[model samples]
Every structure is written in structure tokens, then in C-alpha cells.
Target chain A: MAAARSDRAPRRPTISDVARRAGVSTGTVSRYLNGGHWVSAESSKLITRAIRETGYVANSTARQLRTGRSGTVAFVVDEAPARFFEDPNFEALVVAVGDALAARDRSMVLLLAGDAQSAARAETFLVTSGVDGAVTASAHPEHQLFERIQAAGIPLVNVGSPTGLEDRIAFVAADEREGARLMAEHLIAQGARRIAVIAGPAHSPGGTLRPDAFTAAVDASASEGAAPVVIGLRHGDYTVESGRAAARTLLAEHPEIDGIFAANDQMARGAIDALREDGRSVPEDVLVGGFDDSAFAGTEVPLLTTVRQDFGRIAEELVDALDKQIDAGVRTNVIVPVQLVVRDSTVRPGS
Target chain B: MAAARSDRAPRRPTISDVARRAGVSTGTVSRYLNGGHWVSAESSKLITRAIRETGYVANSTARQLRTGRSGTVAFVVDEAPARFFEDPNFEALVVAVGDALAARDRSMVLLLAGDAQSAARAETFLVTSGVDGAVTASAHPEHQLFERIQAAGIPLVNVGSPTGLEDRIAFVAADEREGARLMAEHLIAQGARRIAVIAGPAHSPGGTLRPDAFTAAVDASASEGAAPVVIGLRHGDYTVESGRAAARTLLAEHPEIDGIFAANDQMARGAIDALREDGRSVPEDVLVGGFDDSAFAGTEVPLLTTVRQDFGRIAEELVDALDKQIDAGVRTNVIVPVQLVVRDSTVRPGS
Candidate 1:
């Protein structure tokens, strides 16, 4: 079919050419391409043959413009671009989202809204880019990006708990409280007496919900007549360096700190580095745990024990919700499960 | 502008509606939208005004379909999806390419052609998806994907040296030979007597070019009266585990090896891990160097010494070449240089 068309036109075929070949109005071809919303089945067959003959693959994005669908969704993150690589947690979710979207035959465009300039640029682009919808990991307090997306009438799926925008936007999140509690129980089981926490930023859900849950778990254990453990909390920016800095401050204030739970793996590795600098042996002198068993989790010398979120399920759910939202115009919230993965950091030798 | 338009249209505007308002054929409106190609100045003004009034934000993709342009490009990586996160090098390049593409107001759709099914899907999608062009890091023996993209008449840009592809396919590459020589000389200066090389897969340009250059440099140094150095070579799949296995094999065969150079940072880090497993201290027992100063480079215990390719410049060059090829039908080749970074891995303490 392509070879036959090759001899007919030196340049690539256009919609007008496809329409002409099909002996129909350009609107018929355009409508046929855009989900065949108003086109007849007879016109649809003609248009389909026209496309095969003309080799019109750009029909997907182009026809969306002529009609209402855009055939693409934006996977947005409101953080510094480096966070995508630095944190490794994003990688798992992004790939899973990409794969899931690909399976659904939807193209994914990544949009970064870290700084004010990028936020403004992303705002303008989202309004004009003709994207079908967005899946955002934006925890920014202002809800500026969300408002822009909403105002543009794009369906949105948020990651983590809601921030009280409108009730209409959907969200998918992991059971963070359960994850944190599991890690705390494991630490207490390992005979940790003085526990220090390296939490993520205060504004983020993981920053607050995780540590709050761990504290509650510890209090519950104390209520059951278990021996009391000294617990202190400090905040980090979810980076390894930030983890190291937070650990330094924790050690300064609580010299007897024997166990640490970092909000994420990068920070957990940082905490371990600080302990090693102070000549402390992991699982011997101190027990440490991290959240998000990322690619960097196992590389830590002690092979970090961490909470593993079901990113695969989260990605699938996010895509599923958005797909349904686009078709059914319904909003839903979903919470995926988490598991505790034990390794050298939290498990004592020969125990 | 958005405020007034929002009140006017509950449904997204279509090209036919814009054409009706502009008092012109849908073809005329589309031609104007594409690039104002054959549309007269008066018609272009009319179509532009109608699009604004109707809130036709999907004009970009739609107009491109009516015409012959896709307005999108494929960034092709023929590797497993895991490689994107596992090997930090791809992250840097992918980001750089994405940023460069975004700056030009173009969308980049990533295509993975690692396995047979994915490669077939990617091939069919590229030919039928109407992407304007593609920048490929493919070194697969078949060149099957390249042939498909070319037959589809999309512009192509290759990364690294060519492998007998058509002259029309542009390429942007880092000088692997010079990078290898610099690393080899640095190791010789560190007074290394026995060196083993961990090369990437033999089919790849990096796999062959880097090791060949390093061997040539070592031989040239030996002729210039440098101490005799025994060099052993083994191949890996540009992975950490593969590098570890390669290093183990090299060590067992040549136990006197005092220095090692892996083609990339991931492998170099793996070699260090192997040396440590044998109770050999980095820089004291074996000096090590790596290529591609990826994010993983600095994370190694001894802070890897590596050759830094100008990924930023390479990305820029690749985009520039493709842009020109898409416009002027000219293909070009660009070779970016590299620099060596000295870190703890190669430098002995207190030297």
C-alpha cells in the first residue's frame, strides 16, 4: 500500500489528500479520525482505507485538534528537574506510568513546574497544548498548577492525599501510615531504644503522615507496657545530603540515638553515611530504615530495610481513573498497599 | 483572553467551526494553521481571528495533520525500560534531549526498541505516528528500526559513530577515542603496571572504540619508554553486574592486575565492588577509572575518576541537525569532545 502511494506523491500525504482520495468532505475525514463521533460507518471505512493508502499516521494528534480529543496526557511534576534522577523513586512511577499509558495507546508528555518561571510557562502551555488530561504529583501549597489545569478544563489525577482543591479531582496514593507503622514495629523488634526520625519536608504528605504514624505506633506499644524508647524528629528535603545534615543535627541534640527511620531511601542512605562517619556499625550500633525501596536502596553498604509502595498499582490506577474520567466524567480516589522489605540495615546478624 | 473565551465555549472548538466563522474552506483554515503555507495573508488573518474567537487551542496538532508536518519527534532508545533508571547515564542524556526539545516548542515521545515486540511496535508506530523526525542511540546489528523510520521518510539523527547507514542520516557523537586515550594516560601516570579493561558490548561503538583507543594509547606509551603494563580485556553488557562478573574473570586470569578501567561509570563502580570483595582497597591496591561522568560516578566509595562527555552540547547538536534536516533537507555530522575528571578513585591519598 505504501509503495503504491510512494509513486503517486513525492511529499508526505495531507488530510486534504486523504479526504480527496476518499471522495468525502475534509470534515468527514477529520470526524472519522477523531473517534468517528459523528461520521457514518460507511465514511469510517472509506477514511480508514484512505489513511492506509495515504500512510497517514499523524491522524491521531491532528484529528484530535480538528475535533475535541487531544490523544495525549501530561504527566506533571512540580519539583526541580533533578529530583527525577536524584530521588530514584520517581523513576519507578514514571516508567510504570509510561508503560501503562503506552499499553493504552496514549502518548505521555512530561511537564515540570518547579520554579515560578516554569510554573507560569507550564500554566500557559497546559492551557494551549490541547492535552486530554493530567496526572500531577504537585504538593505545592498554592494549588496554582491545579487551578490552571482545572481552569483549562483538563481532567486531573493527583498523587498522594488531596489538598482541598475541588472535590472533583481524582487521586491515587499509597498507604503511608501503614508503611511507617510497619517500619517502626520492625525497629522496635530489633531492640532499638532511642529512635530518631528524618522526615521529609513539612508541607508534603509523606513528611507529616509518615512520622505521625510512626509516633502513634510507638505510643501504642508503650501503652501495652513495653519499655519506653526515646523518639525525636527532624525534617529533611528528601535528598541524601539533606538526610546527612538532618542526621548531624539529630545526633547533636540526642547523642544516645540508636535507631533512625528516614522518610525515603536517599535520606536513609545519607543517615547511614553520617553514622559510619561517627564509627557506628549499622544493625550493631544502630538500626536504620527507609521508605521507598528505590534503586539506591540496595546499594547502601548495609542494604537498607525500607517500606515499598506499590508504584505499579498506583500507576495503573492513576491511568485507569484518568481514562474513565475522560470517558465517564467521574472522579475517584484510590489507595495502594505497601510492604516492609527487610535486609541488613534493620535486621541484626544471627538474630 | 482565556476568561472571555471560557464563557463563550463549553465545548472545545473544531477546525470546521473556525473555518465557518472565517468564511473560508476548512482546508484554507488548516493550511493557515499548519504554517500559513499556501494561505494568503488576508486568509491567514481571518483564520487566526476565528481560532481565537472559537477557543481552538487544538490548532497545532490538527493543522499539522491537514498539512504534512507532525510537530513531534521520537527519542529512540533500544534498551530495556529498566536501563533508563538503572544506568544513570541515560537519565542525563534523556533529560538533556527532552529539555532541548521543549525549548523549541516540540514534544518528544520516547520509544524503546529493546526487545522484538517493542522494536516491531516502535517501528510501526514511527512510520504511522507522523513524527517529524527521530534521534536514535541505536547500535543494533539489524538497523531494522532505522530502515523503517527512513522508509517512512522521517528525518534521522544518530548518536555516536555511524555503522554503514545512509549518508542522509545525521549524527552527533562524543570523541570516544580521545576520551579513552586521556584515561589510559592518567592511569599510566599513576604508575600502574597491570591494567584490565571492562568494555561494553562488542557490537556498540563505545564497546569497541573506547577499548581500541585505550590499547593504542597504552602501546604508544610503552614504545615511549614507559614501564611495561599488562592489559587484559573482557566484555560486559554496560551493566554493573556484568562489569562485576567481567572484573572477577579478569582478576582470576591476571591476579597481578593493579589498575582497571571500565567503559562507563556503572561498570567502574562494579569493578570497585569486586576489588573490595577481594579485600583490595581502591587506589592502594587497584587504581580505577571510568567513562561518562554520570550521577552514579560521584556516588562510588572512592568517588570515580571519569571522562565527561558533553551531553548538553551533544543534545544541542542532535536537535540542531534534526531541525535543519526537517527544514532544509540537509544532513550533518557533529563530534563533541570530552574531558577527564580526576577524583579519589585514581588518586592515592596524600600523593
Candidate 2:
């Protein structure tokens, strides 16, 4: 059989045909076409090849003109550059989102909104850099960034719960509270009593919600006549150094804590390092749990026990929501479920 | 003095005025404007704010037409995505290149040219992606990718030696041979006699040039009546795992090896890990030196001693070369010097 020979007619290939070529669900294809978020790499590659082979075009120039849309989606990261590069979680998401967008045949312009100047530049980039819509991540809740972006008449999608614009804007998030609760329960079941919580930034969703759920879980367990209780709570900026510092501080202040729940994996790793320096063993001495099972979690010497956010599903939902909003002037809010991955960090040695 | 309020006449500010405001050399500003590299972050931020405050524009739309520019540059990386993310060197270049470009008020569109399909896509991106010029990094020499881009009449400035069509193209390279020479001298001076070379992919500029230069240095040092000798050679895929695997094989084959010269930092780290597992002490039992003095080099436990490639200078030269070629049809080839950074890895512990 000939490997390549498909030039039947000059007519354009419809998205449905492209979807058939990719062998993915039509809904997935729609998500891909609209906001470039949820499409898997394999399907995207196949769809891309199929489109190239068939010369698929989304619409005529006239329709594009009528829509007044540019073929660009702004990938807005509202965290400082250091945080952007320091956390593997952000890099993983960036790669995932970029791939998803590429599959949809839409170009993405990355904009950093970390400081006032950078934020202003990002706003300028959105308005003057031909960006039609934006997908924001880790924006400060008090900054009114999303409101400003929406006010610019551009569609927006937030990675987590929108800062304060939930009713009008769209968002996609993992179940952070449930993830935290599961982690607490896992530690309790593993015989952890005096637990410590290393939380994220105070106003950020993970910082506030994850710690709240963890505390509630501890209180509920104690109410049910369980032995475990929250002994201390310290905050970290979702960084390894912050986690390490917080752990050192907790160890200095509350040495009786038997379990540590870090809001993110970086902090958990940091806490583990702090424990080792202080001549303590993980799980055996103080059980540790973290959230956001990042790329490097499994690579660690003692593999991390963490809450897993299915980035693929999040990307899919984010793309779908953005696509629907951009195309039909609608808003959607969806929370993908999270899972607890038990690894070396939580399990007792030799168990 | 007032911190704000500068609303002068509607006429656009000039580059000279912007340069003067930033207190940087005129050459630096010109280099920045032509292609987005070489300008340091501190100066770029100042220049950007100055331009913003003054509402500067390069020229009229009619002049822009005469120049046939899109204000967009294609930052082409001719490697697989995994390779792109794995090596810290690539990311450093990306951030540096992006910063360099942004300072000049030019946008960069990233394109990958790893496989045949991606190569085709890159070519298409150069022609159809509104790319005015290209700055290619780590492209395979045999691919004739530069030829195709030049044939497409798009101006280009390569990050290293261009594939085959060298005479017509512009390029900027770190002094690879000199860098290798210095590292070899450093290792030899540290009392290493039996050295093993963990090389990169053979055809890459670093893979070929660094090994050749290192071997030459070893031979030249011998001619100068030195004691160091080449013990073995192994190739790695510029990954930590590859370096570890190569080191394992080298140790099995040549047990007498006393020094390691990995072509890159990733492989160097891998070799270090392999050494630890083999119950060998670094510097005391075996000395190691790496190249690229990557962002993580100082962060490593032993603090890697390696050849430092000035990414900022490379970025600047690359931009200048491309700008010259694109603006005046001139071809430039310049080699910026590299440096040897001594650290914990090579130094004797007691010393």
C-alpha cells in the first residue's frame, strides 16, 4: 500500500472529518478547535497531519473578519519569573497548555504578569499583540487582573477558581479541598498524630482551601474520637526553599508534630530535606504528604506521596470552556477530581 | 522631582533619545533594535520603560513597507521537545533570547525542527508564520534546513556553525575549542592522568568540536611534557541518564580512568551519580569537569566545575548578526570566548 497519496479534491476538510481522522470524540475535537486546551498530544499530531494532508481550513476569510478574531490565544502566567522557572508544576502545565493549543492550530503568545510593569506589558501584549483571548494561571486574587482582561472585551479562562469573578468568568480546577482531606486521612490512617500543615500563599486558592480542608479533616477525626490532631500551621510560597524554612521553623517550635502536609510537592521535598538535616527519617519519624504530584515527585530518592491533579483532564476542560466561551459567549465552571498517590513518603520503611 | 507625568508632543521619540535615556552604548541599542539579543536585562528594562514613557516608534508605516518587516523573528530550535526541556542550557538560551527580543520591541515565535515533519513545519513557519528572520539553535548539520530557509528568502542567524551553507549565512558561536582546551588543562593540572571523555551526539557542534579539542589538548599537553593521557571515550545523548550509562560502561571497560570530561553538564552530573554508586570519591579518586556552566551547575551538591558559555553575549551576537543580514544582506560569523569556572567538583577537599 502506498504510504502517501491523498489529493482528492480542492474542497476544505471539515472539523468532523478531522475528528474522524484523529479517532477522538467529537467533543474533544471541538475543545481542541475552540481554545486549544484539552487535546492530547497523539490525537493532536494525527489531526495535524490529517489537516495538512487534506488542507483543512476552519472558515473563510469573510467569517474571520465578521468574528473580528485573531488566531492567537494569550498564555498568561501571573507569577513572578522566578516562581515560573522554580516550580516544575508551572513548566509541566506550560508544556501541556502549549501542546494543546498547537493541536488546535492556534498560536499562543506567552505573557508574564508578575509585577506592575510586567502586568502592564502583559495587558499591552493582550490588546496590541493580536491576542483574541487569554488563559490565566496563578494571578494574584486582589489584582483585578481578570476583571481588567474581561473589561478589554476579550474572553478569559482561569486555571483555578477565578480570583473573585466566578459568577461571570469561567474556570477549571482540581478538587484541592478533597485532595487535602484525603492526604490528611491517609496520614491519620498511617498513625500520624500531631500533624503540621505547610500551606501556600495566604490569598491563593491552594494556600487557603487546602489548609482549611486539612484542618477540618483533623478536627473531624478528633471529634470522631481519633488520636490525631493539627499541631501547627506554617505557610510556604509553593517553593522548596520556603518549604524547607517552614519545616525548620516548625521543627524548632513544634517538635512533637508527627505528620506534615505540604500544600505542594516542592514544599514536601523541602520538608523532607529539613527532616534529614535534623537527623529524622521520613514516614518513620514524621510522615509527609504533598499535593500536585509534579514530574520530579517520582524521581526523588524516596518517591513522593502526593495528591495528583490530572493535568490532561484539566487542560481538556480548560480548552473546552474557553472554546465554548469564545465561540458562543458562554461561561463554564468545572472541578476535575483529584487522586491520592501513596508512595515511599507516606508508607513506613519495610512496610 | 515628579515620579510621573510625561506627556510631550505627539511626535515619536527617536532611538538616540531612547539610548541616551537608558545610559547605554549606542551600539548596544542598535544591536537590540535590529535583533532582540545582547542587551542586558537591566538596560532592556530601562530602555523599555523609557520608550513607553516617550511613546517611541522606529519609523513610519511607509518606511516599514520599504523594509518588508513583520516585527516578528522565528526562534528555531532544531531538537526534539524532550531535549529542549531536559538540558538547562536550552532553557537559559530561550529565556535570554526572549528577553533580548522583547527589549527591542520585537516578538519571537518559537518553532521546532527535530524530525522531517517538524522540519517541514518549521519551514512553513518561516514563510507563512510572519517570521521576518530566524535564529536557529542546535540544528542538525546534514538536514540542509538553513538552505531551505535561505531559499525561501528569509534571513537567518544561526546560534552555532550553520549546517552546510556557511558562506552565505550569519552565525554566532562560543569558542568551543578554547573552552574544551581550558577544561582539559584544568583537569590535567588537578593531577588527573587517565581521562575518559563522555561525548555528546557526534555530529552536534559541541559533540564534535569539544571532544576533538579536548583530545587535542591532552595530546598538546603531552607534547609539552605533561603526564596526563587519554584512557577511553564514550558517547552520551546529552542527558543525565545517558551520561550515567556511559560512565558505567567506561568504568567497566577502563577501570584505571581517573578523570572525566563530559561534553555537557547534564552528562557530567550523571557521571557524578554513577561515580557515587560505584563507591568512588570525586576529586580525590576521580576528577570531573563539565561544559555549559548551566543554571543548575552552582546549585548541584558538589558545585560543578565547568566551561561557562556566556549566554548573554551569544544572544547579543546572534541578534546583531541576524539584524545585519536581514537589514543589509550581510553575513557575519563571530566566536565569543568561553570561560573556565573552578568549583567544588574539581578542587581537592582539604585544599
Candidate 3:
């Protein structure tokens, strides 16, 4: 189609030229390009054909100016360069978000929120940088800049819910409770009586969700007078170091614990490290499971059993929802699903 | 200085309002603001005072159009997300480049040369997307695109030298040969008699330089009849997995080796894992060093002793060079220095 149009114009025809040729406004052409509006099918066909015929390349800057949009989305993550690299979810989430943004011809700007100064700077950019929307990973509940973003009228999407913001703002996150329940059920089915969990920071939304849900699931599954032992809960900052520290504490507190669940992959890797240091054979001595089916899950020596949250799919939905709001002034609430990924970490002996 | 001139129009003001009040043309005002390029210094000072009085913000885009120059620079890197995140040199380089660009009131656009398709698309944008100049990484050599950029009159600055393109292009890079020599000398000083090397992919320019220089340095250090045994050389793709696989093979083939040098940090990490898996304690049985003092180097149990390339400083120089070319039409070469970061990995027992 583009080739056929190439012969008619020396240069690519622009949307404004098409609008002039079709006797329609530039906004109408823009509406046609960003689908899901009220444009008639015939009008849509005409616009698409015109775009093909002229090989029209949308002037992103002009379109942004006319619509008071930047055609850009910003994403912020809690960052320590080392932690960011080691976290398997970080790579997956960024790739997913980048892919989603590229599909909509929108660029994704990354903001690494680490210190107070950088956070404030990122907030200023988020509000004033002309981005249409934002996606943030609220690792800590008390992040000040995220609050500023919430108040700035930009459509903010959360990869995981932030404390205090969940009730006031819309978010798209994994079903943490269901995923935890699956982990608990798997342990019970494998005849593991004593279960311990290495959780993330106590205040984080995700950290709180998995442990509480797992505890409740365990409580409900036990028969009268034969309840399974809840060994211990240890906290980590979703880093290998913190994970390793938590694992040592958990092991010391409950040496009889037969099953372990870590909230993320880095922590899970730390757990593996601790187990090795303590001379405990994986799956034979203790079954382990982790959250976030990151890229390294399959690559681990004893492959990590994890909860899979399709970050790319969620990212695509987030962009679609934001684009809808930008183009048609519509709003949406989306909930992404999570699934348990069983691997070498969770399998019992002889199973 | 900005507050000195208020409410009064000095001979030639910095802005149009100032120019109007001072009874001068806007062109004269612009020339004055551009540091008396075509105006007297007296006129420039008067214009500055007028600008101070009016509190005028320079419209960079408008100024760019008027001057037929874009206040923007392009930074091109390989599209590998893992490399982008894990390579400390790349991160430091970008931050430094950003600082330099910001200092000149310009913005840096990140261009990804991921694959042939994306590379082609990015090349099209880099040449025609209003960027003033470009800083390209030689690691991902796209010679054809480099030639096209040169033809487009875009001042090109390369990070490293590549085949067929050296001497023609301006470049800023660390002294790879010197860094390799220092690393080899350090290993020799630590009394390592048998050294096995894990080299990066053979295709990259740095890969060839580092290994060749290290071998020469090692040869030079050896006295008559006391040359250290060159155990083995294995190649990796500068990835952690590749490093691990290569390390495993190197260890299997050369069990007597007392020293190891990885071409980069990612490969060094793999060697660490391989050595640990084989029950060889680092710094006691084997001494190891890596290139690129990346974040991973610090995160390890015993931090890696490696070559520290001042990527940020180099990036600053690259941007400064590009700006000089743009503002004064000066072209020059910049050579940044590299340092050896000593850590626990290369330290021998007792010594």
C-alpha cells in the first residue's frame, strides 16, 4: 500500500495534506489514526487509504502540540543500579513497556527514582514535561514524588499499588492474593507441613498482599487438631543481599521449615545462596518458590518456581487505556492476572 | 548580573522587547546575545542587561530554527537491554553526556541500534531528525550508516576505533592497551604464574585490543626462562551466561591456572561462578580481574578488581567536542584515561 502511494508524491504526504484533500479537519484525521473513536467506517477507510496513498507519516510533534499531548509516557522505578540489574522483573517490565509504547508510536522515558533530589526532579518532569501519562513502580509506600504525580492530573498507572494511593487512584497490578494461594496449595499438595515465607519490605503493597494471603490460605486448608506449622516470616528489600540476610534469619528461627516462598526473583536467588551456604539440598531438604517469573527463572541451576505477571501485556493495556483517555476522554480500570510457574525450586523429592 | 538591568533599555538589548526599547533590530539583538559574534561587546552587555530587565527566557527551538541549527545531540548504543542496564560504563557515559548536553542548553536523544530494521530506522531519524551531531558506539559497528551520517554533514564522534573508519572520524575512548597492561602487571605482581584469559567477542575493536595488549605486557614482564604459562583463552559474547560457559570450559581445560582475566565484568562474573562451582576459593587458589568496573563488580561477595574506564568523563569530552564543532567548527580527537580498581578478587593470600 505504501509502495503504491510512493509513486504519487515525491515526499511522504502529511496528515494535514490528507485532511485538506479529504475536506476534513486535522483532528478528524488524528481521530482516525488513533482508533476506537466515533468515526464512520467509510470515513475511516478513506483516511486509511489516504494515509496509504500519501504514505503519510504522522507529525508526532505537531500532533502533540495540537492535542496538548507529548505522545510520550514516563516510567519511574525504585533504583540502585545493582539492584535494578539483578532484578529479573526490571528487564521484563521495561521491555514490555517499551514494546507497548512503540506500538502506539509513543516514546517511553525512563526515570530512575533513587534519592530525594532525583525524585523531585522526576516529579517536575512528570508534571511539566508534556507526557500524556505515567507508569510507576511504587516500591516504597512513603515515596513523596509519586504523591505529587497523583495530584498533577496526569493519568498515573501503577505496576503495583502504592500505599494510600490505591483507594484514590486507578492501578493495574497482578492478583497477588491468588498467586500466594496457589503457592500455598502447591506446598500442601506436596505434603509439606512446615512453611516459611521470605517477604519483601513490610510496608509495600505487594509484600503485604502475598504473606497475608498465604497465611490465610494455610489457615483455611488445615483440618481440626492437625494444623500445619507456620514456621516464620522474614523481610527483605527485594535485593539479593537482603534476601540472603532474611534467609539466614528465617532458617535460624525455624530450622524445621520445609517450604519457602520468596516474593521476587532476586530474593529467591538469595534464598538459594543461603540454602547452599547452610548445606541444605534444594527440594530434597526444602522446597522453594518465588514471585515474578523473570528471565532468569529458567536459567537458574535449579530453575526458579515463580509467579508470572505478564508485564508486557499489562503495559500494552495501560497504554491503550491512556490513549483512549487522550483521544476520546474515556477512563478505564484494568486488573492484570498472575499465574504460578512451577520449576525445580518447588518440586518435592521423587515428584 | 541578571538583576543589574531593569526597566531601562540599554543600547542593544538581549531580546526583541529589549531591542525595541533600545531602538535596535531583533537581528542585532540576537547577534548581541550570541556573544558579540556580529555585534560589539558593548552592545552585547547592553543586550544582556536588557534581557535581565525583561526576564526573557530563550526559546531554544525558535533560536535553533533562526540559526539553522538544532540544539540537540544524538547518542547511539547497541539495542541490547541487558547491556544497557548492566554495563556501568554505558550508564555513566549517558549521565555524563546528558550533563554536557544540558550545559549547552541541548537535549540528548537515545538512538538504539538493536537490529538491522531498527538500525535502519534509527539511522534515518539520526540523519534527518534535527540532531546537530552524533556520538556512536563502535561496539556495534554499522559502517554503512556511519558513512551516510558523514555524507549528511552530521559531525560524527565515535566511542572507539573500527575498521575502515578510523582516523576519518573524531573519537573519545579509554586507553584500552594501557588499561590491559596495568591489569596484567597487577596480576603478575600478585605472583600469579599461570594466567588464563576469558576474552570478549572477537568482532569488537576493544575485544582485540585488550587481549593483545595483555599478552604483550605478560610477555614483556617475563624474564629469561621464567615466563608464566599461558594456560588458555576462551571467548564470550560479553554476557554473564556466556562468561559462565566460557569460564567452565577454561577451568576444565586449564585446571593448573592460578590467575584469570575476563575481557569485561559480565564475563568475569561468569568466571567467578565457574570457579565457585568447582570449589576454588577466589584470591586464595585463583586470582581474577575484569574489565569495566560495572555495578555487578561491586555487588559480588568479593568485589571484582577490574579496569575502571571513566565513561562519564569521556562522554563529557565527546559532547564538548561535538559542541566545539557545532559552535566554532573545530574538530579534534580526545583520549580519556583508564584506571585499575583494586578489590578482593585479585588479592592473593598473605600478600
- Residue clash pairs of candidate 3: B13-B47, B14-B47
Angstrom error at residue B243, model 2: 1.7
Candidate 2 lDDT over B1-351, as tens digits, reads 222422211122345666777787767655554532576656655665544443343321212444545465668787765567767877788777766766776655565556544554455434333346888888776655675576556678888665354586688988999999999988988888889999998667667889989999998895334478878998988999999999999999998989999999999999999999999988779999999999888997888999999998898887777778767778889999999999988998886
What is model 3's DockQ versus the real complex? 0.07
* Residue pairs in candidate 2 whose N, alpha carbon or C atoms collide under 3 angstroms: A38-A316, B36-B100, B36-B101, B38-B316
lDDT string for model 1 (A219-337, tens) is 66743334646468989999899999989888889889989999999899899889888888897888999998888577758899999988889999998888777766789888899
Best-to-worst ranking by TM-score:
2, 1, 3
Candidate 2: docking tier = incorrect
Model 3's CAPRI class is incorrect
Of the two candidates 1 and 2, the one with more favorable DockQ, higher being better, is: 1
Clashing pairs in 1: A57-B128
- What lDDT tens digits, residue by residue, belong to model 2 across residues A46-142? 6555444433333212124435344556678877554676778777776677567656655554555565445544543443223457888988855
lDDT of 3 by residue, B1-351 (tens): 434632221111124566765566788875543423466535544554554344332322234446744555667775555567656666666677766665554455555455443444444444323456788774455435565456445677887655445668777778888988999999988878789888876656446888888888988895445577557888887888888898899888878889998989888888888899999989899999999787668777778999998877887889877767766667777878899999999897578
Give the Cα error of residue B236 in candidate 1, in Å. Answer: 1.4
State the DockQ of every prediction: 0.18, 0.08, 0.07
Best by lDDT: 1
lDDT of 1 by residue, B247-332 (tens): 99999999999899899888898899899898899999899999989885777578999999988899999999987777677889
- On the 0 to 100 scale, the lDDT of residue A86 in model 1 is 70
What ordering of candidates by DockQ runs from best to worst?
1, 2, 3
Q: Write the per-residue lDDT of candidate 3 for residues A1-351, one digit (tens) a residue.
A: 444632212232456767766667778877654431566546645654554343343332334546645455667775643455557677778778877766555456566655443454454344323356777775454555556565445567677765565676556777888988998888777667888888888757547898888888987895444576567988888888888898899999888878888888888888989988999978888888888887778897799888888887788877776666566656566777888888887786578
- Position B233, candidate 1: lDDT: 95
